[model samples]
Target: MPRSIWKGAISFGLVTIPVKLYSATEEKDIAFRQVHASDGGRIKYRRVCEIDGEEIPFPEIAKGYELADGRMVILEKEDFDNLPLATTKAVEVVQFVAEDEVDPTYFNKTYFMQADGPGTKPYVLLRDALVKTGQCALVKVALRSREALALVRPRDGLLVMHTMLWPDELRSGEFAAPPETVSVSDAEVTMAQSFIEALSGDFKPEEYTDAYREALEEVVQSKASGVAMPEQTEAPKEAEVVDLVAALRASVEAAKKRRAEGSAAATG
Candidate 1:
């Protein structure tokens, strides 16, 4: 089993259910290291004190917050440990609301919440209630010394917590919006609808693979073996759609053709 990163309690009304938090997702991207091209020496970093111009030890390093007037306020590890916040070691449920009420963009990281020894009963009760009601709990919790807003919901017999970005953290998209003067005809809208319908299907995440990562791995293998690298294909060029309706119609036809080919391959 994976080791739990955090131990906390879920404050469900007056009942406190002890729980352990585990990370739900991990990145599979290939890692690269910065090194001397000629000798393959690994790069390193050092911490130096600016005021005294001396190398600083890890224990002596402290976090500093810069002020608007250019003054730095140094804060020690002890300062964060003693903060007056109840959510520091607890999952305080604020309210339960319909799951659709929360936007997907607000979600950040995901973690699994497992009940501790005595709290298992209450955890099951809460999970069942959420599943039946189709609601998710809005909560406050602290992880890695930072407080966050999160949503807790039942998934595959486990309680999952998704940390959320604050409202102010989301920037306005007004600058990226198209001008109000731009408009589309009814026929163009219908064609776009057809394209969407042709391409729509149940989401199967496992069917997808990281093509770029696979290609990068092949390149690295070729270099290590002193073999010739695979020949590269020309990148696709974007079409300049002068007629929007014609482009939409073509897209719909292409989507339908692909779907038909996929179905035929599966049957054969």
Candidate 2:
């Protein structure tokens, strides 16, 4: 089992449920190390002081806040721990709202809450209640030296918390005005609706994959084994549509044909 990152309690009204927070997701991104192109040697960096031009050890490095006037304010670990922030390690549910009311844009990192011994009953109660009501609890939690707004919801018989981005952190998306001059005809809209209906199906996340990552993994394995890498063929580009209505009609027909072929292959 993976180790828990945080130990806290969920303050639900009069009850407090002790829980441990575990990261709900993990990144599978391919990472590369910096290396010299000619000799293939790993690159190394040293932290040097700007004023003294001397390499500084990790222990001697201190957090500094530089002022606009070229002055620096250094802070220690003790100073951070004594800061005037509510450092109480608890997830306080402030309000409950319909699950749809929470905009997905505000969501950041997600963590799974596991009941910490003695609090299992209360934790199950909250999870069941959320599942029945289909509501999410808006909460405040302190993690990583800062307080954050979070949403708690039930998922697979467990309470999951998603930290939210502050409203001010979200940028206004007013880059350009909507194209009012462009309009769609009823026939074009109907054909487009047909295309959508033909292509629509239940979303199964397992069916999709990162093809690029798989190809990169194959390349790495082949190179290690002294085998030739597989050749890749470029996909043919679609011809530009001169007529909007014609394109919509063609799309609907293509969707229907693909669906019919898929059904035939499945039955076969």
Candidate 3:
């Protein structure tokens, strides 16, 4: 089992449900180490004090905040523990909102909340309530050294928490919007929507694979085994469409053809 990253209780009204938080997702990107290009000798680094010129160990390290006046303020673990925040040790429920009401752009990281000892019954109660009510709880909690706005919702019979961004953290997207001057004909809009319909299907996440990661893994394996690297395939080029309506019609036909091929392969 994966180790829990955080241990706290969900503050649901007057009830407390003790839970352990575990990261709900991971990246599969291949990792590489810094090395000498000539002979592949691994590169190493050391943390040394500027004044003493002595290498410092990890345990000896402490966070330092630099001031504009060229002064440093050192902080200890005890300092953070004494900070004024109720969320440091517990997840606090603030309010409930329809899940769709919260913009997905505010979401940051997700975690699975497993019930701790003696809290299983209450955890099940909260999870079931959320599932039945069709609403998610807006929450606040401190994790990874800071208090964060978060959401707790039930997913597949378990309580899931997602950290959210502050409202000010989001950038204005007005610049990306299409200008009012750029107008489209009704026919073009209909045909573009037709292309969308042709390509649409149930969103099966399992059907997609990261081809670039797979190719990168192959390259790494080849380098390790003294074999030739995998040959790269040329990307498909889009056909030039000078007319807007013709482009939309061609796209609809191409999308339909691809969908037909996919269906045939699935059935066969």
Candidate 4:
């Protein structure tokens, strides 16, 4: 079993349920190490103190807070352990709201919450209630020395927490909006709707693969085996739309043709 990263309690009104938090996702990206290209020797770095120009050991390292006037305050582990925030051992539920009300842009990481100690019954109660009402609990939690806004909801008989970004952390997009003069006609919109409808289907995440990562891996394997790299194909150029309605109509027809071919192949 995967080890839990955090141990805490969910404050359900006056009742408290002990829970363990585990990360719900894992990354599968290809990683590279820095090395001397000529000799294939691994590169190394040291944590050197700026003031003394001396290498510092891991045990001597402490968290530093730089003041506006350039003063540095070094804090130890005890300082963080004694922080005034209640989020240390508690996932404080502030309120419950409709899941759809939360914007997707604010979401960061997801973690699975499992019932611990004698909290299974209360955990199930909360999960079932959330599932029935289609709501999620807004909560505050602290993980890895930082407090965060989070949403707690039920998923497949389990409680999941999604960490959210603070409002100020989101960037304003006022500069990126299209100018007032840019507009689409009714006929173009209608054709675009038809095109979207033709291509609409249930999302199947398993159907997609990371083509770039796969190609990169093949390239690395070829170099390791002293074999020639695979020839690259030219990517299709994007069409510059002079007539929006014409482009939309062509897209709709192409989508329809693909759907018809797929259905025929399935039947055959």
Which candidate leads in lDDT? 4
Candidate 1 residue runs with Cα over 4 Å from true position? 68-71
lDDT tens digits, residue span 56-174, model 1: 99988889999999999999988888889999889999999888999999999999999999999999999999999999999999888788999999999999999999999998999
Clashes found in each candidate (C-alpha, N, C closer than 3 A): 0, 0, 0, 0
Q: Clashes in model 4: which pairs? A: none
Give the per-residue Cα lDDT of candidate 1 at 134.
95
- lDDT-wise, the better of 2 and 4 is 4
Please write out the lDDT profile of model 2 over residues 1-268, one tens digit for every residue: 9999999799999998999999999988778889999998999999999899999999999899999998999999887767775535689999999878988999999999999998999999999999888898999988876788999999877889999999999988777666879887888888888888889999989979999988888888998899998677889999988887889888888888988998899899
**Model 3, TM vs. native:** 0.93
Q: Show model 4 residue runs off by greater than 4 Å.
A: 264-268
Residue 143 local lDDT, model 1: 86
Could you arrange the candidates by TM-score from highest to lowest? Answer: 4, 1, 3, 2
Spell out the clash pairs found in candidate 1: none
Candidate number of the best TM-score: 4
> What tens-digit string does per-residue lDDT give for candidate 4 at 72-108?
9999999998999899999999999998999999999
CA RMSD for every model? 1.6, 2.0, 1.7, 1.4
